[model samples]
Target chain A: MTYCVAMNLAEGLVFVSDSRTNAGVDNIATFRKLHIFGTPGERLVVLQTAGNLATSQSVISLLRQRLDGEEANLHNVDSLFEAARLVGSTLQEVVEHDCGNVQRQGVDLGCSVLLGGQIGEEQPRLFNIYPQGNFIEATRDTPYFQIGESKYGKPILDRALNHATPLEQALRCALISFDSTIRSNLSVGMPLDLLVYHAGSLEVPQGFRVKEGDAYFEGIRAQWCSGLRQLLGELPAPPGDYWS
Target chain B: MTYCVAMNLAEGLVFVSDSRTNAGVDNIATFRKLHIFGTPGERLVVLQTAGNLATSQSVISLLRQRLDGEEANLHNVDSLFEAARLVGSTLQEVVEHDCGNVQRQGVDLGCSVLLGGQIGEEQPRLFNIYPQGNFIEATRDTPYFQIGESKYGKPILDRALNHATPLEQALRCALISFDSTIRSNLSVGMPLDLLVYHAGSLEVPQGFRVKEGDAYFEGIRAQWCSGLRQLLGELPAPPGDYWS
Candidate 1:
C-alpha cells in the first residue's frame, strides 16, 4: 500500500508522497515514491507513484532511460501534457512486458501515478495516469489527484482545498490529508517527500524530506489531533430528539 | 452498497447506518439496514447489515422466523455473545440456501453484519459477523467496527474514538465518521438509522431515524466542515524548508 497526492493550485503545484512499500507485513521496506525530473528554467516534471513497487520502478527506469535520447525526455517535451503522455506510454510498455508473469504468481500488476509540474511560462498542470496507460488531467474545478490509500485522506481535501488556495495553504492541506491517512493506516508510514513549486520559478522547487520527529510535521500532527478533539467538544450535542 | 458502524463504549453502545441499496448506479433505491430484535427489559439487540441486499434480507427473515418457533431466538439468547452466534449461524444458513443459485446469475453472495447490544445482566457488546458466519467481538483496544464503504469514514473514528469515550461523544464521533463517508462516497447516503444504548439499562434505547433535512445532523455537518477548514488554517505551515 502507498499514498501519493498532488495538487495543481492557482499559485503553483504541490506534491506529497509516503515512502513505505510492502509485499506483505513481514516484507516491509522504505522506497521513495516521488521522482523529480527537470532542466532548470526549461521544465520541471514530478512523478508520485503508487501500487505495485516493481511496476512503478520499472516505469521510472524507462522514463529515465529515455532521458539520454534527444527526442523524448522531460527536458525537451513541448508541454506538461506531452510529458504525461510519454510517462503513460512508458508505464504501459513496462506493464505489458511484466504483467503476464507477475499475474501468474497471483500478484496484481496495478500502478498509477500523479504527474505534475510547470513547463516554461505555462500554468502548472497535473495528471493522474492509470495503469492502463490512459490518463485524466486535473481541471480547475477539481485541482488535485490522489493515488493509493486515498479515501481515508480524501475528505480533508474535499473540504479544505480549491484552485485558488495559496501555495502555503495547499501544502498545509496536503499534509493534513497525509496526517489523517498515516494516523489511521499502518501501511502508509512516515518520512514524507513533499515538493512545492512556485508557478513560474522552475528552479529546484522549495520542499522537504520530512521524517518522524521532524519538528514541523510533529507539531502539525499534535496540534491537529487536540484541535479536532476541542472542536468536536465545542459543537452542540445533537438536539434532545436526536438522543431520546 | 451500505455503510454501517457500531461502537462499544464505556457509557454504552452506538450504531449508525446508511439506507442506500443499488444493483447498479441506475438501479439505486433506499432500504433500511438497521434492525432491532429483542424483549425490552431482558435484552436489546441491534443488527446492522451490509453487502448483498438479498442475502442480508434472507438472513434477517430467518432470524425473525425463529422468533415464532420453539428454538432459541434473540429473546432467549443467554448473552449478547450467544445472540451474535445465533445471528452468524442464521446468516450462514441463508447463504447456504441461496448462494449457488444467486451465483449462477453472476451475483456475489456477500453479506456481513454488526451485532451489538445487551442481554439480561450481560455488559453491552459488539461483534462483526462475517459472511462465513464467524464473528469477532470488539475488544477494548479496538472498540468499534464498520462494514461496507468503510475506508472513507475510518480515519475519523481512528482519531476520535476509544473504549472509554462517553456515549454522547461516541455518537458525535460516529456522525463525523458518517459525514466524511457520505461526502466522499456516493453509495452511502442519507436517511440514517441511529441507536444509542445506555449500558446496563436494558430498557428501550434512545435513538432517531435521521433524514436529509434533520436539524441536528445538518448542524453537525456544517460545524464539522468549517471546523476542519478552520483547524487547518490555524496549524503552522510546514517549516520554511517545506515552502521556501
Candidate 2:
C-alpha cells in the first residue's frame, strides 16, 4: 500500500509520497517511492510509484539502467508526455513479466505511477500513468493526481486545489492530505519525500525528506486536529425541531 | 452504491445515511437507506444498508414481512445483538437467493448493514453486519462503522470520534463526514437521513432529513471549507531550509 500525490499549479508543481510498503500487517518495510531523473539544466522528471513493490522497483531500475544508454529514456525524452510514455511502458513491461507467476499465488503485480516535470521551455506537467501503459495528463480544471489509498485524503484536495493555487499553498495542501491518509491508514507511513518545482525552471528540483518528529509536520498535524475540533464545536447543532 | 455510517457513543447512537442509489452513473434514484424498527418505549432499532440495492431492499422487505409473524423479528428481538443477528442472517438469505442469477449477469448481490439501537436495559449498541451473515459489535475503542464509499469520510471520524464524544459532537462529526463523502463521490448525495438516539430513551428517535438547501447543512459546509483554508494558511509552511 502507498499514497503519492502531485499537483500542477500555475506557478509550479508539488509532489509528495509516503515510504511504507507492506506484504501484510506483520511484514512491513520502508522504501522510497519517489525517484528523481533527468539532466540538471535541461529536463527534470520526477516519478512516484505505488502498488507492487517488485514491479515498481523493476520499472525504476530499468529506467535508470537505460538513462545512460542510447534508448529513449527519461533523460532523453523530448517532452513530459514522452517521459510519461516511457515510464508507463516500463511499468507495463515489469507487470507483464511477473504477473503470471504472481497471480497464480493470488498476488497483484500491477503498479501505478505519477510522472511530473518540466522540459526546456515547456510548462511543468503532471501525468498519472496506469498499469496498462496508458496515461492521462493533468490540466487546468483538474490540477492534481493521486494514486494508492487516495480516497482517505481526496476530499481536501477536491475542496481546496485548483490550477490558480500558489505552489507553496499547494504544497501545504499536499502535506495535509498526506497527514489525513497516514492517520487513517496504517499502510501509508512516514518519512515522506517532497519536491517543489518552479514553472519553466529546467533545473532538477531539490527534494526534501520529512521524517518522524519533523517540527513542521508535527505542528500541522496537531494544529489541524485541534482546529477541526474547535470548528466542529462552533458549528450549530441540529435545530431543536429535529430532536423531537 | 450508497454511504451509511453509525456511531456508538457514551450519550447514545448516531446514524447517518445518504439517500442516493445508483445502478450506474445515469441510473440514479433517491431511496432511504435508514430504517427504524422496534416497539416505541420498549426497543429502538435503526438499520442502515449499503451495497446492491435489490439485495438491501429484499433484506428490509423480509424483515418487515416477518414483523407480525411467529418468526423472530426486530420488534420481537430481546437485545440489540439479537436484532443484528436477525439482520445479518436476513442479508445472507437474500444474497444466497439472488447471487447465482445475479452473478450470471455479472452483477453483485451483496449488501452490508449497520444495526444500532437500544433494547430493554442494555446500553446503546452498534453492529456492522457483513454480507456473510456475520457481525461485529462496536466497542469503546472503535465506536463507528461506515459502509460503501466510506474512505473519503473516514479520516475525520478516525481523528475526532471516540466512545466519550458528546452525542451532539458525534452528530456534527457524522454530518461533516457525510459532507466530505458527498463532495468527493458522485454516488453519495443529498437529502441525508440522520437519526440520534439518547441512551435509556426507549421511544422512537426522530429522524432528520437534510436536503440540499438546508440552512444549517449549508452553513456547516461553508464554514468547514473556509475554516480548513484558514487553518492551512496559519500553519507554517515547510522551513526555508527544505526549499533549496
Candidate 3:
C-alpha cells in the first residue's frame, strides 16, 4: 500500500509520499515512491509513484534513461503537461512488457502516478496519470491530485486545499493528512518524502525526508491532534429541543 | 454507496447512517439503514446496514419477521454478542434464499452491518458482521466499527476517539466524520439517521433524522469546516532548518 499526494498551489507545487510496500502482510518492505528529475534553472519535474513497485521503478528508470536520448525527456518535454503524457506512455510500456506473467499469477497490474512541476515558462501544473495511458490535469478549483491509499487522507485536502493556499501551509496540511493516515493505517509509515517547489524556480525544490521523531513533524502531529480535540470541545452541541 | 458508522464507547453506543441509496448516479433514493430491536430496559440492539439496498432491506425484514418464531429472536438473545451472531445468521439466510437468482443475473447479494447495544446484564458491545456470516467485535483499542464508505470519515475518529471518550463528545466526532464524508461523496448525503444509546437505559435511544436545513446538523457542519480551517492555521510550520 502507498499514499502519495501533490498540490498545485499559487506559490507552487508540493509532493509527498509514504515509502512502504508489501505483497502480503508477512512480506512488507520499504521502497521510495517519490522521484525527481530536472535540469537546474530549466525545468523541475516530480513524479510520485504508487502500486506495483516494480512497475513504478521501471517507469522512473525508463524516464531517467531517456534523459540521454535525443527524444523528448522530462528535461526536454514541450510542457509540463507533455511530460505527464510521456510518463503515462512510459508506464503503459512497462506494464505491457512486465505485467503479463505477474497478472497471470493474480497480481494487480495497475499503478497511479502524480506528476507535478514547471516546464520553462509554463505555469506549474499537476496531473494524475492512471494505470492506463490516460491522465487528468488538476485545475484551480481542485488544484491537487493524490494516488494510492488516498481516501484516508483525502478529507483534509478536500476541505483545506485551494489555489491560493501558501506553499508552506499546503505542505503543513499535507503533513497533517499524512499523520492521520499513518496513525490509522500500518501500511503507510514514517520516513516520508516531501518536496516544496516555488513556481518558476524551475530547480530542485527543498526536500525533506521526515523520519520518526523528526522534531517538526512530531510537533505538528501532536499539536494538530490536541488542537482538533479542543476545537471539537468548543463547538456548540445540538440543543436539547433540537433532538426532542 | 452508503456511509454508516457505529461506535462502542464506555458511555454507550452511537450509530449514524446516511439515507441516500442509488442504483447508479441517475437513480437516487432514500432508505432507512438503521434498525432497532429491544425489550425496553431489558435489551436494546441497533443494527446499521450498508451495501446492496435490496439485500440489506431483506436482512432487516427477515430479522423482523423472525420475532414471531419459536427460535432465538432478537428479543430473546442471551447477550448483545448473541444478537450480533443472530444478525449474521439472518443475513446469511437472506443471502441463501435471495442471492441465487440475483447472482444469476450478475448482481451482488452482500451487505455489511454494524451491530451495537446492550442486552440483559451483559455490557454493551459492538460487532461488525460481514456478509459471510462472520463478525468481529470492537475492542478497547478500536472502539468503533464503520460500514460503507468508511475511509473518508475514519481519520477524525482515528485521531480523537478513545474508549473513555464521553458519549456526547463521541457523538460530536461522528457528526464531524459524517460531515466530511457527505461533503466529499455524492452518494452519501443529507437526511441522516442517528441513534444515541445510553448503556443501561436501553429502550429506543434518542433517534434523529438529520435532514437538510436541520438547524443543529447545519450548525455543526458549518462550525466543523471553519473550525478545521482555523485549527490548520494554528499548526506551526516545519522549522526552516528542519527542511534544510
Isolated chain A: TM-score per model?
A: 0.97, 0.97, 0.96
Question: Which regions of candidate 1 deviate over 4 angstroms?
Answer: none
- Superposed Cα deviation of residue A184, candidate 1 (Å): 0.9
What is the per-residue lDDT of model 3 for residues B51-142, given as tens digits with 9 covering 90 to 100?
A: 98888898888889889889999888788778888888888888899866778998888899999889888889999999898999999998
Q: Summarize candidate 1's per-residue lDDT along A163-214 as a digit string, tens digits.
A: 9999898888888899999988889988999998888888766457998889
lDDT of 1 by residue, B119-164 (tens): 8878889999998999999999999999999988888888889999
lDDT of each: 0.89, 0.90, 0.87
Model 3 interface DockQ: 0.63
**Candidate 3 at A25: error in angstroms?**
2.1
DockQ of 1: 0.71
Ten contiguous residues with the weakest lDDT in model 1 chain A? A199-208
Docking verdict class for candidate 2: medium
Candidate 2 chain B lowest-lDDT run of ten:
B235-244
* Residue A243 shift from truth in candidate 2, angstroms: 1.9
What tens-digit string does per-residue lDDT give for candidate 2 at A110-205?
Answer: 899999999988888999999888999999999999999999999999988899988888888899999999999999999999989888777786
Better of 1 and 3 by lDDT: 1
Model 1: per-residue Cα lDDT at residue B48 = 96
Q: A198 in model 2: Cα distance from truth in Å?
A: 1.2
Q: Quote the lDDT for A138 in model 1.
A: 99
